[model samples]
Target: MEYEPAEYQKLQVRQYAPRELRETAEGKYWRQFKAPIVAKQFGGVTHIDFCQQYPYNLAVTASTRVIIYNGLAPAVVGRTISRFKDIAYSGCFRSDGRLVCAGGQDGVVQVFDANSRSVLRQFKLHKRATRVARFGADKLHVLSGSDDVTVRWWDVSAGSQVLRLDGHRDYVRAAAASPASSDTWLTGSYDHTVKLWDVRAGGSAMLSLEHGAPVEDVAFFPSGSIAVTAGGNCLCVWDLLGGGGGRLLKRLDNFQKTVTCVRLSPLAGPDSAAAPRMLAGSLDGHVKIFELDSFLVTHASKYPAPVMSLGLSPDCRLLAVGMADGNLSVRKHARPKRAGVGAGPGAPEPRQRRAPRLTAANYRYFIRGQNSRAAASDYRVVRQRQVRLQAYDRMLRQFRYRESLDAALATRQPEVVASVLEELAARGGLAGALGGRDAEGLLPLLRHLVKYIAEPRYTRLLAGMAHRLLDTYSGVVGTAPAVDKALGVLRDRLAEELGVQDQLSGLAGALEPLLAASLAGALF
Candidate 1:
C-alpha cells in the first residue's frame, strides 16, 4: 500500500507527538524563541567532566560511586570505583591524565593514577569535606576548594599544603584555574561573591563579583580575558581585561531560576568570534548557552532533572549533562559556524533533519512551511529520498541505537516528510515511516514493530522550524476544514498514547528541574 494521507487525516498529527515534546513545541510556537539546550540524563548525573575528550565522562553518586560512559554506552571505570570509606566532596583529573583526585567528606584529598585505577596518595587537608581538586600548570601547585571555608594550595610533588587562601567566608561552591596563568585561581561561594587569588602573590582578592546568592559555578573563557559566574537565578558576566581590575558586564536575568553548573568552551581562541562560549545547567533542568561578547541565551536544551552539573567536550561540540538521577546525557551541541563556512563546493546541500538520536516519546520535529507545503511535486521528491532512509532507520533502530548516527545525517533524506505524514495518519514514526503510511495497513504494522523495537530518548536539537508554522495558526488553529480534520487526528492519536498525570507527586522528585524556572523563589 502507498503512504498517502487524506486531507482530513493529515490534520491529526497534533496528538501523535509526546506530551513533553508538545509542551515545548507549543511554547516555541508562541514566540520565535531561541532554544535552551535539551539534556540527556547520565547514570544519575551527580557530577560530570568533559575533560576526558570523549562522550565518555565521569559522574559521581551521592554515595560516592564514580561511573563512566563512552557517550552512548556505559562501562564502569574500574573494579575499585569509589567505596563508602574513600569517597568525599571533590574529585578531578590532573592535566596529564595520569592522576585523578577526590576530596573525601572525611577531610582527606586522595590522588589516584587512572592508568592503574588505584589510589596514589592521600593527605588529610581539613576537618570537614574538601570539595574540589585542580592541578595548576606550574606542576608545583595543586589547588583544593573546600566546604571548610578555605582554599588550599598544595605542592603535589612535595605532598604538603604550601599556602591557604582564607578570603571566602562561606562554603566555596566552585573553583577554577586561569587558562594563561596557573598561578591564578578563582573561587565562588554561598556568601554571594567570587574571589580571585594568586598562590604566589600573598593575600586578598584580585577581582570580585558581588552577586546576591550562592555562586554555584565559575569558569574562565579560553581567551583568559573574561570569566563567568552563576549565582542564584542570574548568570553574571564580567570582563577580565584593561588596566588593573576587571569589571562587571551585565547579568542575564531571564533564567528566573538558580544556576547549578557553568562551563566555558575549552577550544576558544583570540579572534573576537573565537571568544569562548558558555554552557550552563540549571536548577530548572535546562542547559542554556551564552555567547561571550553578547550576553543572551543563544540556545537552550532541556533535561528532566535538576541539572546540578555539566561539562563540555574538548572540541566544544558535545555536552555531558549530569542530572540529579545519576544519568549523564551525552548530547551534541551545535557548533558555531563562522560566515564563509562551507562543507565542500561539490557536496550536496545538507537537508534539515531531526537529530540523529530522537525518541518518539520525547522527540522534537521540525517542518518548514515549504517542507509541509501541500505541493505534490515536492512531496514526490521527498518521498523518494525518505524511501531509502526508511530502510536504514530500521537497521539502526534494531541495533538498540548503538549504531552511529552518521547514516541519518549522510544523505538528503525526506525523513521529516515521511514522519509527519505517518503521525498525521495515525502511524508512528519508528515503524510507520520505515513502512509506508497507508492508514489501515500502517497502524497494524506499527503495533507489530512496537512490541519489538524500544525507542531511544530524544533531545530537541532543532525545533523552531516546525514551530514557525505552528506560530502562524495561533495555538493550533487552522482553516475550518483543516481544524476539524486535525482534531480528528489529534483525538485518535492522543487516546492511544497520550497519558496524563492528574497529580504532581506522581511525576516524582525527578521533575523538580522541569519546574524550577517557573517556581524559583517558592522552592529555593
Candidate 2:
C-alpha cells in the first residue's frame, strides 16, 4: 500500500543462512497463506496439495525435511532419504531406482546408493550448489544444473565428470534433455529464460521458458510435444512441438506460493480422446492435480508442512509427496470402477488407496538443511530422545504394587525406573513428552510421582476423577496405619469375595510384578 524505505533493504531467502533463514517464509511470500486471508478474497477451497503418508521419498529445505508418502496404507512409509551434510538444492532418482543423487550448498554432488545406505561418492561440481540432475537421453549420461550457471555431464557409472555444458547468464535452476533426441537438452535460469542445448553443437542458446518468475523445475511430457514448469505459484505447460515455443496449455493463477514438484503420467489418456493427469506440489503445503486436456484441477491433498519434493512410481497409481518436515507420505489414488453417476449397491468395491512398497533400501528420505558436521549433531539428538522415551514408557506399566514394593525398595527396582527417567530428562525428551499427561502413562507414574515430576501440584486436580472411580470401587485402604490395621483384621472374612490371601512374605520380596505374576498365591 505504501512504500517505506529503511536504511537497507531486506535480505532475500537465498541470502539467509540455513539456521538464520526467516521463520514462516512460506506464509510471508504466499500473501494468501492463511485460510482467513484466502476466504476473505475468494470464497473457495484454498489448500489442495495431495500429501502422501508413506515413506517413499523425503524433501529437504534449509535444515528441515519433508517425507514423501508412498501411497501405502497408513501412508508415510519407508526409510528417510537422509544423508546430506548441507542444504540440498536439488535431487533425482537414478535410472534403475537404486541411487539417489543430490547437490548440496557446498558445491558438492553426493550420490547415495539406496540399497547400501552409504555414500557412494561426493564430488565438487561448481563453486555454488548444484540444483538439478537429469538422465542423459540414453540414461547412461547425467546432467546437473548449478548456481554457477553451468550444466555439467557425469559418467554416472565411472563416478566422474565427463564434460561441462556452459552458456547461461544467471544461475541455472533446471535442466532437462529431450527423451527422443540424444544431442538435445534444455536448461532454465534465474535470468528469466530457458535455453535449449545441443551436445554435438557444443553449448549454445537453443530456447528459453518465457515466464514471470525464475523457473523452479521443468519436465517433458511423454509426448515430447510440451514441457511443464512450476514457476512461483503458477503451473505452465509449454508447447515443445513448435520449436519449443512458449505456448501456454494451462495455468492455475491462485497458488499462494512457489511450486515445489510436478509429475505427469507417462501414458497419455486411456484412448486418443483422454486427457493427461498432472500433479503439482507447492511450498504452501498443497498438491493440486489437473486434467491436462481440460486444464481443470480435479484433486488435492493438504499438508501441514511445505512440500519440497515428489515422485511417481512406474505406475501412476502411487503418488509420493514430500514435506518440509522429516516425514514422507505416499498416497494411492483409487478410481471407482464405475466412473459416471453412482448407481449400484454392489459396485465392484471401491478400489483401495494404498502406498507403494517401501523398505529400508528404497525409501525416499530427504536429509535437508543439515551441514555434514551438523548431521552428526542431529543424529545424536534425535536418536537419543527416541530411546529415552521407550525406556520411560517401559518403566510405568505398573503391573502390581503391594507384592513388589517391599522388594523393589530393597533391590532398587523403583530406583531403576527413577534412574531411567532421570537419564531421559538429561537428554531433554521424556520430561517434555511426559509433561502433565504422564499421570496415567505408566502405572508406576502414580507409584513414583517424583520420577516423572517432582511436584504433584496439578495432580491433586484429579480429585474429581478419583471420586468418580472410587464411587464404583472401595478405597485402596493403605495411606494411614489405623485404616491398614482395620482392613487387615477384616481381610479374612472378606477374602473369598475380594480374592485376598495370606501369601508368603519371602520370595515375593525379590521379583518384579511381571516375574511375580508367574508365581501366584504362594507365600513360601
Please provide TM-scores, in order, for all candidate models, with all chains considered together: 0.55, 0.48
- How high is the lDDT of residue 319 in model 1? 55
Mind giving the per-residue lDDT tens digits that candidate 2 earns over 1-524?
A: 99785332211111212434453422222222222101010111111122221122332222311122232332333434456666665555555445666676677776666555578776675888776655564556677788898888777678888878777778888766676676677777777676777776665666665767777767777666688877788877788656445566666764799985677754343222355567788889888766776677666668777777665543234455556564455544443113212222222344568966555565343443345466444646554333332222333323222222222333434344344334443444443433333223324333333222222332232332233333422444345454344434434434442342234334356556757666764645
Worst 10 residues of 2 by lDDT: 36-45
Please, what are the lDDT tens digits per residue for candidate 1 over residues 408-450?
3333333433343333234333332233222332233223223
* Candidate 2 vs. true structure, TM-score: 0.48
RMSD of 2: 28.2
lDDT of each: 0.58, 0.53
